[model samples]
Target chain A: MEVALETNAVFVGIEYLAIFVWGLSGGLSAVRKRYDLFSILTCAWMTALGGGLVRDTLLGDLPPVGITDKGYILTCLASGLVVAVAHPEIMRLKWTMVAIDALGLGLFAVNGTAKALAFGSSGMTAVFLGMATALAGGLFRDLMVGEVPMIIRDKHLYAVPSLIGCILTVIVYKIVRAGTVGMQWEMALDVVIVAVVFVLRMVSVACNLTFPGAVDRGGGASS
Target chain B: MEVALETNAVFVGIEYLAIFVWGLSGGLSAVRKRYDLFSILTCAWMTALGGGLVRDTLLGDLPPVGITDKGYILTCLASGLVVAVAHPEIMRLKWTMVAIDALGLGLFAVNGTAKALAFGSSGMTAVFLGMATALAGGLFRDLMVGEVPMIIRDKHLYAVPSLIGCILTVIVYKIVRAGTVGMQWEMALDVVIVAVVFVLRMVSVACNLTFPGAVDRGGGASS
Candidate 1:
């Protein structure tokens, strides 16, 4: 029981860090669009918190944390402010942002799965929620900025990486329960899943791997 | 009991019509964007069905009807095809589209309230749901196109008109239940509410009415 509680706390910390990275990316993107400061902050907030808000509302939770918790809002605001002020330097740190975003994706996948399980969702539902948590924020940001969602269209393993991470997390949880592994081991297993997702995403991007095309140019059917 | 069922059926019909109008608007917008036929159809479908999808998911309903119902998708597709083939000439009838949109808003607000009440939601929640149903589709469209959500930033009475219509619908339902009005009169009440909402929105637009400004233009405050 103590071990489970400790694992939960670690999960919460990862979730917060993921939110911060996502918020920063969204803020920078809004700035690129020449939006006013208020619009930039709005985009940051939505990108950081929108997925969780959708998840909570769909689960019939009241007053979603994104709307009710001052901490979450403050985190978004602070991240946005930092990015806005450090825009020149941050623009040169593309690889760093990509690395952090990969980490954010892995952590969010685990957090989403755990939260869905906590809410008593079935395995399929939990997997969907995990994917939603990891990808929906980026999707929202892309849609808000009039770009095709990377998960939906880009030639990279974005959604696949998140999906793999979620599947790994769920599998690990089930295996640990079946094998009677300790709570510390479960946390370690989660870390391994995150590493797998991060590495897979990086390798896929390097190799230019992509999902089968869904739509072809020139109005022809592809898939 | 017969009267109650009839009233519910009328509300449902009005809701469907509202959906059709919103769907048409979405279809027209997609055509204007010069998206290929499939992309136009997808955008139109999302615009028409996105609001109700959000509402139902928030209420814990699964696989929102917009995804599951063949008729809904068909309607959106047909609307898109019509607008796409009609070309730029269709854009000339701006007043027609605006009038239809206003009527759709009123119908959607009333339907949202009725649905919420049927689901046993509190009165305040019902009202919010009504406004959400009326505005969410347009919000999704704007967000997808990388524009500030007109409902959130514009000073127009867009959402306010829906709010009034929803409140009036709920009040009428309550009064009718208390036997203060006959069944025929209760039906008339819904029509009156819709008319009032349509007029209110048109007047507000014509008069350039807007909400009080909340954010300062100058960079005085931190993000």
Candidate 2:
């Protein structure tokens, strides 16, 4: 939680960018589902902020950062409004949306874990919180749209890369003894984890990589 | 949070009953949707425990009581397993499930408000959290099962009665000066609110009561 104060100024740009991209996807998803405007706003906010809300709450931080920050709320709403007005055009740029989403996912996963560690969470709890921060919004959106959550059902490797990012974050914290480390190191580690998550997610998508265990073997399985 | 300890012994009976009933409905919902058994357990936990988890997290309580208490988890899973294996027989007792669900809804709404007040939250916030604790799980379950959430889209008044109960609970706290009040008054208030919710929910179902505002006017101007 304290780390947020230091990162707030430097990373404000990326944060808003991530929020906008995530919120846009959320709005587009709701529009595609034929949900009304109010529902579109809900989807947009969920996609942009739900993960952070869950992470903060799990960390025993009430009045989640996402809710308390006016800028965060406005940025998410702006993205939703943009999508609502320009959905047809946005839909045409599908790959662009995917790339932006991947970027948001990585940044969120890294920051979420680091924040949890700053709040004194154990390594495993921090990892879980990080992944939740990255993936919960999409799961929420998928459910809201009456679809099975892609994270659990689709072999997209969405959670896998997020997990790796979160783990790397914890490892960096462990090596540097987070509290004693310099802010620059913490920020640098954040960049590294985000890059790792972004690259892994993009590569997995491009190469169509997935966990073998998730595939259905059909009725011929020996079991 | 402290109130839970004092009320735990006296209310433990009703708590388990609510958990069992909610869990059963969750499992039944998943079974009806032809979801896998693991998904059935997920539905059951979400229906029986998700509300509490959200409430606790929002209140800045770490390790939600629902998760910390082994009995709670087991009860939810047990109910899910029971329904998964015996759904046809369980579905036959449709009225029974309704009665039990109404009971669970009442208990959760009342206790959720009381718990929030005990945690030193404001009156309105307590009311909001109470309604959330009662209704969120069902909303989560409905979403998971690929249905328009009954609370938001359906005319069943699922949340209306729960809201009334939660508001009544906060009012009771205001009149009683919660922290200064004895366990007896607290317990008495819980029973009264639960009774009100149960009666209202059942009567609404029986007499088909619903908010006139929620009714869609369709294309016609008037009737």
Candidate 3:
């Protein structure tokens, strides 16, 4: 029972950290656009909570924790406030922000999949839910500011790492659930998967890796 | 019980019609952007179902009808296909499309509020949910195309009528639920509210009505 409690606490802590980092990313986006404080906060809350909200809704989890938990809301607001007041300072830490954001992506991917599986979702559905939970926050922030979602447009590895992490998480979860492994093993594997995903994201960014764009249809084709 | 069944049928029909019309609007937007067939369908589905999905999630109505109901999906797909194959014809009927879209807004507004109330949401929350149900589809479509949502930027009325309709729906729903009026009366009043909202939207469009823009802070002030 104590082990279970510790596990829950650890996951909750990760969730809060992810929300704060994502909120900061959201605030930076709004500040870059020269929006007011209210809009900045709006972006922060939406970017931090939107993905989880969608995942929970899809998985039949009502009254999602993002809205119900005071900590989540306060953390999001604080992140937004920090960015609004000191954007230049935040901007100076560009690489640090990117690393934190990548870590948040991995955290969200694992957390979302675990929750979805706990809710009795199929492995396939849970993987998609996890990816959505990792990606939808940034998607919301971009959409609010009338920009094409960078997940699709940018030549960077965002969705790929999350997808890989989610798939691995689902595999490990199933293996553990089937009694092939202990709870501790599953937890350890989850951490490893998240770390690998983070590392993969960082490498992709460093190398500027990208998927091929649209195929040539011969109408002013760039390809 | 027979009356209740008939009322459900009526609302179901309205919901399907609203989905179809909104899907067409989405498809039109995609076509105007010269998007491919898949993207047109995506836009249609998002615009037709996005609002209801958000509303249902917020109201704790899990496994939202937009995903579970085959009729809704089929209607949205059919609308998209119709627009894709005959966009010129669809564009030629601009006024007809506008009228249908306005009527759809009213239908969605009433339907969303009714569902939220059924799910035990507060009256105030239901009003916002209803407005979201009416407006979120277009917001999704606009965002997909990287355009500012017309609900915020357009000169013509959109949200106002939806807001009025939702407020009226919530008031009438509460009044009827309090046992002061019958279900039939509530249904009748709902139709009246929808009609009023439709008329209000059309009048606003005809008159080119607009709300005041953001307060000018003298930074290249247009006001």
Give fnat of each prediction, in order. 0.07, 0.17, 0.19
Clashing pairs in 2: none
- Candidate 1 C-alpha lDDT tens digits along A91-175: 6777877887888888878777767766777777888988888888888787766778767787888899899988887877777
Give the runs in model 3 whose Cα sits over 4 Å from its true position. A1-6, A36-38, A62-71, A207-223, B1-53, B57-117, B121-131, B141-146, B151-223
DockQ, every prediction: 0.08, 0.11, 0.13
User: Which model is ahead, 1 or 2, in terms of lDDT?
Assistant: 2
Q: Which candidate is the best by DockQ?
A: 3
Q: Write the per-residue lDDT of candidate 3 for residues B1-223, one digit (tens) a residue.
A: 2212126676668667778888998999999999999999999999999998878777676678679879889999999999999999988998887888898899888888777777777776677678878988888899888787776456677787888999999889888879998867877888898899999999888888754332333332221
Model 3 chain B poorest ten-residue lDDT run: B214-223
The residue-level lDDT of candidate 3 at B89 comes to 93
Model 3 residue A189 lDDT score? 89
lDDT of 2 by residue, A124-180 (tens): 668768887998888888877877776646555677788899899888888777467
In candidate 2, which residue ranges exceed 4 Å CA deviation?
Answer: A1-50, A57-118, A122-128, A140-149, A152-223, B1-6, B34-42, B53-89, B121-125, B144-146, B153-157, B171-183, B206-223
> Pairing residues by index, what is the TM-score of model 3?
0.60
Q: Give each candidate's interface RMSD in Å.
A: 7.7, 7.9, 6.7
The true-versus-predicted C-alpha distance at residue B217 of model 1, in Å, is: 6.7
